[model samples]
Every structure is written in C-alpha cells, then in structure tokens.
Target: MNVKSGSAFFLKVIAILIGIAVLAVCIYWLPAAARRDAIERPGDYSLYPLLVCAYGVCITFSVVLYQVFKLLTNIEKNNAFSELSLHSLKLIKKCAFAVIFFILLAIVYLKVLTQFTGDDPAGPISLGLMGILATSVVAAFMDVLQKPLKNVLDEQLKND
Candidate 1:
C-alpha cells in the first residue's frame, strides 16, 4: 500500500482499538461503578437513568467511530474529496449532537433527582456542559468542512 493508504489503515486500526476500549469500559467499568454506587448509597441512588445516559453516550461513540472508519476508508481509496467523505463527516457531526443531547437529558434528569435527594448536581451538570461544548465544536468543524467540500464539488460539476 501507498503511504497515504498506510496512514489511513493505521488510523482505522486506532479507531477500532478505541472502540474496543470504550466497549470494555462500558461493559465492565460502568457496571462496576454502578455497583459501587449501589453498595455505597443502597436504595437512595438512581442507577437506571445513570446507566441509560452512559449507554446512550456510548452508542454515540460507536456511531462516531464507525463514521471515522468510513472516512478513513474514503481516504485510503483516494476519495477523501468525494461526497462519501462529506457524508461521513456529517454523520460524525450528528453523532456528536446526539452525545450532547444525551448528556443534556442526563443532566436534566439528575437535576430533578437532586432536588428530592439533596444531592448536588453541579459536578454532573458541569461535565454535561463540557460535553455540549465539545460536541458543538465538532459540529462546527463539520459545517466548516462541508462548506469547502460543497464548493469543490460544485466547481467540479461546473467544469464538467
């Protein structure tokens, strides 16, 4: 394979490794953390919603990773400037938005629970806001990339 394709392949491998790591954390670490919380708080903690939020975020992560893999494949095929790459970027952006949505929903749920349980929601809310900020940046980057790609595609059409 060529250098560019080799790099793309390396990146794809990295993405797959990241997916596996995230999956391990979600399947093992998250449940273990939940169990710890349960043991500490007994019946007072709301475990299900927390798990739902975590799993929801994990779903988004998988989607984004898949999209990244698609994008890398396009690059490997030397079609990084094609519509498929643009579409993959768009899908990644959507996944980022989904992450933000899930985090926000979790924050709202935790806020409601905190009111009755007397638990401080500041930490989680801050984390959610950070997630929102990160996703917003990703979406903006996708939007920026789309603009240039659209222009190039339009130019290509005009040339033809």
Candidate 2:
C-alpha cells in the first residue's frame, strides 16, 4: 500500500525477472542455436566469455536492486533516512566513479578495435554499456532516496 512496500515489491519482481533471464541464457539459449553458430563460425570464439560476463552483469544488477529495496524498507522501519541517505550518497559516488572509469576504458577499447582483428568488438562494448547502465540506475535510485531525507533534514533544521 505504501511507497516503501510498493518499491520493495517492484524490486523483488525485477530480481525474479533477472533470474529468469540469466537462466534462459545459461540453460536454454546458449546451448542451442547460438552456441552452435558460435562454434561453426570462424571468429574469435568468445561466446563463453560473453555469456559468463552477461551472467555476472545480470546477477550484479539484481543484487544491487535487492540491496536498494532492503535499504528502503530499513529506512522506513528505523526512520533513519538521514543515515541511509548518506550511505546511498556514498554508493552513488562510487557508482559514478565506476561508470566514468568504465567509459574511459571502453573508449580506449573502441579506439583499438582494429588491433583486435579477431572478431566483432561488440561484446566488450555491450558489457561496458551494461555496466554504465546499471550504475546509472543505482545512482538514480540513490538520488530519489535522497530527496525525502533532504526534506526531513530541512524540516528538522527549521524546527530548531
């Protein structure tokens, strides 16, 4: 009924979806036509590496969502939004740094794409994008959580 409850439910649903996707890729899709094609093709044979990276990314994304949902529920219970907000801010900062670092690395990889001369460079690019996107989502969630804490802090200061 409340915002926190709704957010928690949404996060659980997302986790489920991510789990399903990972399973589909690992159990169903990868062992079928895609794997066959990758083997038959005369490329870099990076299918296994790509699949592993993708699985890791999906897992990490789901875990982050779960953590944020848990944080929200805890915030609601303890009325300690200020402390959690600060923690979220720290997480946001770290995520931002990670995004920036990945972006730079991806750019360098792209610049040197020609040197690879093995197969398509899309795998690394896609992985980098996924990382950037995941960090962006977490950072945005932190920003959303920060608003209420900011309001509470401001109201407390005004009362004082």
- Name the best candidate (by lDDT): 1
Candidate 2, superposed: residue stretches over 4 Å from native:
1-7, 22-34, 41-56, 75-85, 92-107, 116-160
**Model 1, poorest ten-residue lDDT window?**
44-53
**For residues 1-160, what per-residue lDDT tens digits would candidate 2 score against the true structure?**
7887676667767756776776676678756856686779857554554454445544444455455555656655755656665665556555455554646555455646546765566776676777677667767766876777778878888898
Which segments of candidate 1 are over 4 A away from where they belong? 37-45
Clash count (model 2, backbone only): 0
Rate residue 97 of model 2 by lDDT.
56
Model 1 agreement with the true structure over 1-160: per-residue lDDT tens digits = 8888889989999999999998998999999999899889889668788789899999889989999999888888779889898888888888888888889889999999989889998998998898899889998998898889888988988999
Single out the weakest 10-residue window by summed lDDT for candidate 2.
Answer: 46-55
